[model samples]
Target: MFEKKVNIYNVFELRCKTTCYFGVGAIDKMRDISEYLSKRGMKKVIVVTDPVAYKVTGAWDVVTKYFNQFGIEYVLYDKVTPNPTVEQIDEATKLGKEFGAQVVFGIGGGSPIDTAKSVAVLLEYEGKTGAELYEGKFTPEKAKPIIAINTTHGTGTEVDRFAVASILEKEYKPAIAYDCIYPLFSIDDPQLMVTLPYKQTLYTTIDALNHITEASTTLARNPYSILLAKETVRLIATYLPQALSNPNDLNARYWLLYASAIAGISFDNGLLHFTHALEHPLSAVKPDLAHGLGLAMLLPAVVKEIYPFVAEILAEVYEPIVPGLEGKPGEAEKIAKGIEDWLFNMGITEKLESVGFNEGHVEKLTELAMTTPSLGLLLSVAPIKAEKEVIARIYRNSLKRM
Candidate 1:
């Protein structure tokens, strides 16, 4: 048993903006969603999705079937790719504006859902570009309502208020968090997630784990964050391996999806620090690198450095997967190594070197992290102060596993 640290004196608030429908057969809620849109006179919807996931997961059939039945008019923007770019959001927004879209429906994982959040904002603030949105030039108070149809068990984008996008010209990736961007409705049906490829299954699960790890220990952490983080890690530890071994195991998928949602809500309130802030720069520099893979590579180094500041909370949060890590003040190195070895055994074996990053790239990556619009905010909440040297060291240590 482990004690979850909570300070009663700290002021904190918990809120969830999205109305989420979750479970094994939750995809059928699409019909109810369509009817609600119809009643609200939000019949013109633009769907943002990746080309592959929607069709392969049978979400396309279910969504379209309901849209047709409800007399909903929709346009498809299926070109969203991983690490979605400003160009993608602008293109989707243009199409939506032209089609007189009243609602934004994002289907698939983080990229498409995040793109939909940007598109929703852009459509409401007509004439604004994705670059401008991500650059923080506009502080949007409201946007067209978004409906997130999640097809993956990771990326709590379906239930959170944060969105990320890349500005390729400057090689910058930044995130935006707004009260208005939370999905008006969300559907998390594990049945739709059954077809997730093996690598994605692992990568997305890592992403959720990182979310809780950072959220539970950030300066903004509260009772809500710590409580949810513990449950999130326990669920992932138990269900992820089962889901990996039996892809069609709906029970495993359901719990993983549930975990992802709570993790998203946890971070929505508690916020994140090193892993997410640093990973953004890596993925920005190497667009092909999956976001979760970048975080996994950097996580151990981050844990090793910040463990002293957040030892008790993180130890409790990770105890489910990496046991007996509590109350060891001088065991940061051991704890980090344990996490690295566990992730490796779970199938994430490549290091920064495998992605072509080296000592030469560390300076550039650090600069990007410091200057990226909203990344600095995330860095500010880290338990350890992230000076250039500290940031550079983490990158260097991650070059190859210790």
Candidate 2:
């Protein structure tokens, strides 16, 4: 146990890149959004969104009203799907290019926002393809302006500089983080999130939870990450269940959205490690898997491995859900079990096997984790050295119910 009296004696850098408008009426900022773009001579826009969430949330109606009032021209690419692909980004980029789009608006959760970020970057470089961009063949210096109109309680994509897209052919889900992809403006209106279905509400919030859990303990973590991660956990722990029970609880939705945005900022500053690093392979191998559910499945196994290295910090933050966790070396197993139980109680009861993965798939998952473009960097920053054996073991451990 290393819980000592804490003191702030070190200095670290923090980055808060996006100008975010959050609250009940935050979407009304669309008027200011139009002005922001008009002021910058960005009239034509490409909107990236899923087919359903944007329309049902009424975000599209509100945004288009402002666009029409401001005399802004826009094209909608509403075909973005979950686990957006390189092909999808390229498709959207082509549409943007053809439409002479000057601004990109991502109008859903991670999938759309991430696709928008990728599209924004691809639009800047005339001939660049999503394959080349994800392959790390080019480092983009700048991108067309991106505006994030986030409509989910998860995916701090609105506030972060990272984007994920899959190369379905190769089963690779590589993430790109460029300062240029940071959204110029963001809206986090919880009103837009009230209609989020039960499973989505659960999965998305879990995604936010996983972000901070890994960010706080990664090698890149500092006081800023820890501080924000703690608050993120507190808010999620306090509010997620209420939103789960009553899908229309605006107060619960508000705090959860706030937690998600800050969680994005936490990871933006602290970076992420095991859970995210490993989950990408799971979702890449099985594109139907929601990223958060994959991460939820892997979290306990990852915590078991990482707890010893940062026991006091893990115990401090995780205490809200798993009370009585102690900062001790041998307690990793207990912490992992406690967390598994917590997740089960939260209705995340599916195991890897239940989701169609078996022992045979572990080898492929392990290979992908080690060889994926940016994943090795995540592994290097993990609290534990995630060797091939360690990665395989985590996957195997997650294949069964606790």
Candidate 3:
């Protein structure tokens, strides 16, 4: 552990311009709120969501009914995929244009919300298709305002201006961007989340935990973000399972839900460290694995990669979650071991191989990981750049969990 006083560079970047209103009962209060949209000068809106959202929360119906009753025309493009691609963004964006969508009301989990963010930027800058936008020179031209409605309690992706989508050239390779990173509105309604499947409930919790881990432990050192990162994990350790087992524990759901929004804020503050960077390639190659699954698989390994600079802080913050993890001999090692051991009890399959990756696939997964936008995340932590070889090793490590 490189231990004297540590110095971390605080590069402050705040990307979310969209105001978020969070509450357990916000949706109910939001009825007949077309005046708000009218004040924003929005004539029409586009909703990016999946079918499950329709069944789980009646969010789709509520939005449709409200807008219809208010005479605000809107269209729905429910074709967004779990790991959305350039095609989906285009389809939704096109639909938005067809309907003269002035506002994009993205519903559901990260997927639809993220798709809406991408489409808003694409439609605003009509000069490029999803693929074209990813070309050598990518810049957002014109984008309509976006209203994000979160249904899942994880990956605050909807909380920021970032949109992570797969490109055509590299099918699973991630293409993340900060251009046109502004949302007009973002909403977190927990009622919509009460119906998320149990597996997803756990999956998304891990995802939120990873956001904090990376932000606090990654290569970049920002003092302000470290606590935000730590708090994200702490809240999860305290609340995720309560929500998982009880399902309707409003207090548990609300706290974990708060953790999600705060973690989103932390990740958006610019330091989205290595776990995300590492998970990107794993997911591109194995789309069967949920984003949260890939993240859960990679996080413990990534914690091992955490720089000794912040090891003590990381371990102390994480101790409560890993039984007997605090002040142990080789605390960092113990922490990582605790994570693996705990995950095993939870019945989560961390190995990519268990999730269907072969030993032979490592090279490509690592190759693509090196190019992910957040790859710099690796450089900041462990003071290791995860150059091609290192990235390949991380991929292999994740492929067959240790």
Candidate 4:
């Protein structure tokens, strides 16, 4: 068991290994990017993405042209969705196998980039689907060389070891093999996210916000992670509204993108919390609501209820951002409440029913959320007891005008 009760005051050891490059037109750096990893007998390549990224980043055309120029044969799989499913992964794996593609390039936002991670693992054992990677059987050796290109500000899932693949209704199981970490490289160019729609601007920022803040207040929270989380929240709070207000402003978009990436790293350093664990099931079922929107709707309630449970951790997390509030009585609560209000202030909060979940589905949804493996990993920290009833409370609190 990785869980151990320890003094929360200890300085925790932080581990991170992904190489990240951030800039305005970093996509143009692709040729150099490809050469650094694609050297030593280039194998058949696959680019996993969606039509939106192809159109938005123009990376598909640009990259395909490069692959062709280098005389390295490649295939394109753009059928990825927001909450990528097993069927999609299976189909993508089949295409990769048919092409004999050994290198997978995930290009776009977290969705396609995340899908690319799942595809690389399952494609190694084509006919087996998510089965091969579900349990202890999956490993780095089973994965093809994967590369990530970021086109959005949310889900630094591009640089992390987590891949969420939906097998059925409102259900996603992560394909987590530690080797899944080395996806060759990640290319982050803020310009790609600049033209993104304002609605995406809002929701994806919510995702980043959850990643940073949740990791900060997570039970096994570390000081370094808390600091990053605080800075991340401040960055998102500072930049998201500006980007929303001015969609074409590259600098605003750049800062927001970097904040998202920082939050992603915070999670990679091991603080993904209950908000993500809960939000996945919401989107896995609704399909219509964007993942970011789902996070927007669910997080604040979790924040309100769970924040007090992890107050000491959260105090450290919020201190760097809110500064003056830590030592004073009631000030920490004030800061935490401010964080929640700021989420609302930035339009990151919404009614769950407005997105999809209604009273009709609450109990079962809550039941599954509590029992799912994701919850086990999350609750291992805080150990949310009165388990079934606590979920009931979360469901009721999440209720909005339907």
Clashing pairs in 2: none
Superior candidate under TM-score, 2 versus 4: 2
Q: How accurate is candidate 4 locally (lDDT)?
A: 0.69
Q: How many clashing pairs does model 1 include?
A: 0
Model 3 ranges off by over 4 Å: 1-16, 323-330, 372-383
Model 2: lowest-lDDT 10 consecutive positions: 3-12
How many steric overlaps does candidate 2 have? 0
Off by over 4 Å in 4: 1-16, 131-141, 169-177, 315-340, 383-386
* lDDT string, candidate 3, 169-288, tens digits: 564445455646556666667777888888888888878887777666555546666777767777787777688778877667766777887787776663665677777776666666
- Best-to-worst ranking by lDDT: 1, 2, 3, 4
Between prediction 1 and prediction 4, the one with superior TM-score is 1
The collision pairs in model 3 are 124-142, 124-143, 125-142, 219-380, 219-381
Please, what are the lDDT tens digits per residue for candidate 2 over residues 1-402? 121232212111123688888777788889998987887788999999999989999999999999998889999999999999999999999999999999999999999999999999999998999989987999999999999999888889999999999998899988889999999889888889989989899999999999999899988999999999888888888889999999988878888988999999999999998889889988998999998899999999988888889999999988888788778878899989998998898899998998999999999999999988988888898888889999999999999975
In model 3, where is the ten-residue run with the lowest total lDDT? 3-12
Write down the RMSD of candidate 2 (Cα, Å).
Answer: 5.3
Give each prediction's root-mean-square deviation over alpha carbons: 5.1, 5.3, 6.5, 7.1
Runs of candidate 2 with Cα error greater than 4 angstroms are 1-15
